[model samples]
Target chain A: MKPVATIEGRAIPLGLKNLDTDVIIPAHWLKTITRDGLGKGAFETLRAEPGNILDDPEYAGAPILIAGDNFGCGSSREHAAWALADLGIAAVIAPSFSDIFSGNAFKNGILTVALPQEAVDRLLEVARDHPVTVDLDSQTVTTPFQDRFAFAIDPFRKHCLSEGLDEIGLTLASSAAIGAFERMEGRPWLVPSASPANVGLNGTIA
Target chain B: MASRPRTLYEKIWDAHVVERREDGTCLLYIDRHLVHEVTSPQAFEGLRVAGRRVRRPELTLAVPDHNVPTTARLGADGTPLPIADPESAAQLAALTRNTAEFGIPYIPATAPAQGIVHVVGPEQGFSLPGATVVCGDSHTAAHGGIGALAFGIGTSEVEHVLATQTLLLAGSKTMEVRVEGDLGPGITAKDLILHIIGRIGTAGGTGHVIEYRGRVFEEMSVEGRLTVCNMSIEGGARAGLIAPDETVFAWLEGRPMAPAGEAWDAALAWWRTLATDPGARFDKSVVIDAAEVEPTVTWGTSPEDVAGIGGHVPDPDSFADPAKQAAAAKSLAYMGLAPGTPLSDIPVENVFIGSCTNSRIEDLRAAAAVLDGRTKAPGVKWAIAVPGSGLVKRQAEAEGLDRIFTAAGFEWREPGCSACLAMNPDKVPAGERCASTSNRNFVGRQGPGARTHLMSPAMAAAAAVTGRLTDVRALMAS
Candidate 1:
């Protein structure tokens, strides 16, 4: 996890809504058995077009992507998130994101900032060659030019992100509570009585 | 105190609830979880960040599909090329690492158990009656073949279910879709679903749970039932389910995840009791005649906007509903289709049979049957059939289904979600029209400006050979 809450970097503007995961990384590139080379395939479609966002020399080394609303709307392909991270995109600012894609991004240590459409539009205009700062603690995204936009994240997600906690983390955090619940009146139904090796079953904690 | 008899839906719903909130929603426990390469990484990451072990790792199963390459090695020029695409590789790698870290059992690429998550779940007996199963994919509803309350969930929710084995859900109204009588020879499960979607507009089943009943559904095989329920979301239903029966039990017997010996016998007895009672009531009901259903195909973007094979396209002006008429007109304009033209005349540039929607062994067989000894349209750019799983791929090959497809000029590729969307290199060129067996036909679903005519696998095969939307019955008759 990144030690700092705010990440300030150059932005690459991609102004389009509903830009699905497929466009981020085409399915043909999924044959390999490693995540190491995924950066090469990220935004291949865009790169194919002349003067596209990734191919523009002016935006070289952009670490932030200011995009349109409803980004990453199709298939729960996490490679899209991996590709973005590998491509040096530390943060993504969009009007909204597919719930699955957002979770994938967060898990990969990439920040997803959901701003209003107007804010997204303004950022897209200034995103090119401009450095943007994102502060998770304040829940705000700002530009060097005095533009500051605050956003909201699910409290649960915020907690996980802050603590670097995942599903396993959540389960371990609540292990004691889970243990107590298993001992309640609904014990028989919640825990299998016959499966002795499985924990929470009958008098067995194995 | 008097208690009214509860519907099968209500009974299942109540049994799974661990807690109820003031809004009347229930925190229902998820009895089983299915995962796929496409959706598990983030969920696993959430688990890691939370420092949690899978609450019930044994309750969850994973498989690799979706992003795996199809053809062995053929570059854009069609020469023998090595199959190593970086994006899919990363996705697969992440899944392998994540599942291993979480102690989740997974069927990797080409493994006997590796297939579409929906297909593998039922085949392995992981999907059982009266259980609440959750997956990160929408087609999880296919598990309802066993009378289970199965549905798709978001990644965060996947994380939730992994940690607590419970889902927080809003209550939904119950709807019964009853179809009785016999389906004609040429008609299949795909046609029946298209007919239903035609009757009820795409959004008709919004905010409801669907129960499929009647003689037609009763006679359908487990796979057929799965096909019907798989598209419920396309019609706006939260899920579609069927009552469990002997066929369900027979299908589950002897599978990898199934109970054995005495346990199996007891499970069968319990499964039998999971069916709906005779007098159970629903919030709404619609009755349909199976005999009236014909081989149907979608003529436009939405599944509901479909017509029979030989039927002329609907005249937008004939629709009394202004909104529907307007939508029809828009669809027709975008599709470049003329009103009153026979659906059989719509030209197709390619044919694809794949996706979590309809890539089962039966679907492949149907396509093969249509393509037997037939040469495809001379100029058709592509005609391919992709099975949903490695198990399906092997079974199809064992039956020589691959030979029939290849002899007919179709490509028989490895199992994966290929060309369902324009994700893979298998995409149809922009502005081309295709006849596909996959479910969705939204605007540009196959590619930018690409027109998709959704049909059954056999129908897609017929179109591939004829270069147009021809009636599969005619081909069969010939």
Candidate 2:
């Protein structure tokens, strides 16, 4: 979960649009609660094909995937991200991703890099012959041909990734602040319960 | 201060608002947290590291459905299928362990009463009107059949609900969809929803919450409402809701979790008020003729690209919008269907009539009605009917529905999401087309190179018998 400082790898190009989570890892694979062993089932049907990218020796151990537009659509299953991570895909280059999928991927320490279609086209071309490098520090994706394309991630996500902080991690990091808020309980000051319902229900820990 | 009157949605929305932030998101209190075996493990782990307990154990429930195999009776070596795959077994085991540790109720996979979480929620009366319910499963919107403010949340949201019993929301606009008159004899709730979706188009209800109203909805059985609401997501609606009425109360009156006697009376009194008022305003409205809905089916990829069976696939060029035309053309080519080609001529290799959407007892009966004394088409690779829950499975068997299915050369299997996405062993092989009761027919949804034509259960059954996507109306009329 370290802040992904840089990503350098080959791109296994999956040139399909609206690749939903059902297609990514499938609903059946979700029956397992553990995040383990999902790599085997990720895109099982696709892998079943003789020359699928996952099975193709040429793309073996690729760390980047260049997907078509509207990738990661459908059910907001986090396992989709887990499966991709387990498959060693560190970054996904797409025109866009489903909002929920991007959030899940970000939380799991996978970089979802959005780029212009032209840049994506170029990278896809470059991907056919050589590895690509993505540097989070510089926010740039570079090709072995010395071409570099700058990208952006949400500052908050960048911070979270840099700090290895999840929602709970961030919340727990503010334990003292939370303790101070708790001490404000019963006082006639400092963020009283918003509603009468909240008098019993909101953050009252009991 | 502004003093605008509150709408029913606003009242209910405000009642559940636990906290609000500057970002304009309301942290709403969730009263019921329903979890299935599939989506709870990670959330439980998130809690363990935090050293926290489920904030409100009494308000949570768990069940297993997604991974349970229905028809794989034994292994190649003749041993019983030891839960088919290890992942599902581990997930189920984790659910059992977590529910036990948290003192929460869990309906285990092998339990005679186990089934889909959504079906069990209302059938057992655990989901009530005017309360907020959250489940890790997306189809949790199925609980909205009770007029509850129900929504499906992600696993992180699940963890949030477990620890805080609340979720962040940006709220949603309300739309009233009114259906009048009675449905024609052969038409079912599945057809009605398809008719609505066809008219509204997918993404019509984006950022809105739909309240299904009118005499048609009022008269619908709970199962019917669930069938309609289950596909709300398909229509791109945040959620679908129906107000609680006498029918709602009656449906929940004597179930396991329903309040008894006086408490039930109090609950009913409150539930009755969950409806929209006479003068309540909606952001949008749509009306449909209940009688006009036929045994509808989807011929193309997206749900909105559907038309009534016996109708021709529409010509892309006829549409003025280029994007729409492109989409239609793509769907037409992928489905191997041409413009003006009657949908009835579309041959199919498989027929699946089961999923959280259309696999209830009522759905089974409807399919059985069509398949009575009929046999499946020759050389069909797969034709099966899967019930949604264990209760439906048992009820179907007790009533000889299973025998009718078997007699018709259809496989009657245990309850799970069978062939819905063809994720497990049940799948349509590459390039095979199928008639599916489950929602979504996106390319390869059932399996790689598998084509799915979404239809009602009866239509699926009719297609099973005919080996093609035949119009059920023709079969029904025959």
Candidate 3:
């Protein structure tokens, strides 16, 4: 993970509501073991349509995406966020996000900013003709036309995004405390099937 | 006067928090990790790429469910279904190979008890009370029924748990839903949850983990409890839970994964103390009368756009908020439904009864019970019952439920999530409407351009028999 302060580029104005993870990356393309090559599959169906924003060279390789309400509305497949990142999307502007998707997006280093629909509609129009910028440090999405819309983010998440600290990194940072906690009386919860003692299902796996 | 006591959510959460940091994040020990074919391959790849080993392979379980075909068209010598698509086949193969390489216990598609990830974990006791569980699928919240603090995670988080056996999580707000009074005879857990979601829109449970308490949930069947918890994700909840009790213990007693003899007794003793204190406080609470709930169905794409089976699609003008009005109108238009149209008269071309939501034995029985003496309506094209697992299929056959479904013109087949999603070969065609018992009713979820109406198993069966969205309670009466 790498820290990111601001993303400045052309924005793909794909304001489609209820744009589920499946639409972002169809299930057929989820077969690959590696996250590589997912950008080609991102918005596979939409990319097929004529004049699709994903296909329009005007917004090619854009890092900011302006999406409609309820973006990432279905499935817990993190591939949706992964694919978006692979397509060079650093931030998504939506009215709201499904809880799971928002969590996934954050974990993947993609900023999700929720603004009112009117603000988003304005951004969609501005994004068409000029570049837009999302500054995580200031929590504002600004367009060259001086359209400034502020957003809210959890302070903790904002720190993580700026610090590039993933869960593993955070755990390593608190390794000393984790060691103390593990020294307590309780053992890690284990399945009987793999318990250290002589077990019924299998001879012993642990 | 000082304060209400800590809630069940707080107790379980406090017990699991290993280390709390000033940054509003904490490390929680995850007791179990459930993985399925669809979402885990990339996570495993990440592990291989990073040269890391599974921290606690024993605590992780994998299964192939979402992609395998439902019908049991085995090879000549009797083997697993010949996978139809290359993508689904590759996903399942990748899961099997990865689980074996990681030294995790994987319940394969051919395993008699193997089924949807959510159903297999609790029924097998891999998920237990007071434990923290996670899976890459949202419906893993279903495991919360057994009093575990279980919820969904993404592939990155899945890999995080695989490497550390712990998760860095932000605390969730707690809400309590109190449902009193007895449920009417014909009502089911599906109806109760749909009613709740309808009252509170899809985002109602955002950032909160809900504890479903009160007489209705306390006395509900274990299967019914699973059904209610299964759709908790649809409510946008981090998870939904019921306190552990004798019923849960009785259900877990002899399962293969449960502790035995002395261990079991010790586990039960601890479980008994896992209830919310009487004076426990919640950040938010809502009370509802279970008796007032009707046989419910979602008429549109979102779970919250629901109504009673006997009611009509809501008029967009009924919503005072402009955004809500636009959403309602869009949903109705996308569903090809007219405002003020009787929901009962909405013609159905397909009826699919299977999914993690309602594919267990109890669900099959409910649907079979409705189809016992009736045939599908003249207009219905395809109606099928795909069991959740190979064991569920065999049990249905043993009880002649398969014959009942077949006689009623329904295709009774082998188990693997079938019509709930289009990941496999079984899917409703474009421009058709399907009465489904799955948790989600998202557009094209059943297939491209296929409209899905979410409902309970009985409602699906009734739709098959009546060629429309007929109320299951009405059919039970007449």
Per-residue lDDT of A160-181 in model 1, one digit per residue for the tens?
Answer: 5677664444444545654554
- The reply for model 2, stretches above 4 Å from the true place, is A1-17, A28-32, A36-71, A83-165, A168-206, B1-8, B72-81, B180-182, B284-292, B314-334, B379-381
DockQ of 2: 0.14
- The TM-score measured for candidate 3 stands at 0.93
lDDT, candidate 3, B1-478, per-residue tens: 2245777777777877778778767788788888898888988898898788887788788878888887665667876565777777888789889987998877777666677888777766778887888999888888888888889999988988898888888888988888989888888999999999887677778788989998888888888888898888787788999998899989887766777776777677777877998887788888888878989988887888888877898899998767678777877877898889999989999999989889889999999999999999988899989887666787889999999999999998777778887888889888789999998887667887788999999999999999999988878888
Instruction: Output the lDDT of residue B87, model 3.
Output: 76
Better-scoring candidate (DockQ), 2 or 3: 3
What's model 1's lDDT at B179? Answer: 92
Candidate 1: chain B TM-score against the reference chain B: 0.94
DockQ of each: 0.09, 0.14, 0.39
- The C-alpha stretches of model 3 lying farther than 4 A from their native spots are A44-58, A116-122, A145-150, A169-183, A186-206, B1-4
| Error in Å for residue B146 of model 3 | 1.3
Write one digit per residue (lDDT tens) for candidate 2, span A45-126.
5677687776778888999999866667566678888899999988999877755577678878889998987898899899
lDDT score for candidate 3 against the true structure: 0.83
Model 3 lDDT tens row, A3-44: 979999999998876677877877766666677778888887
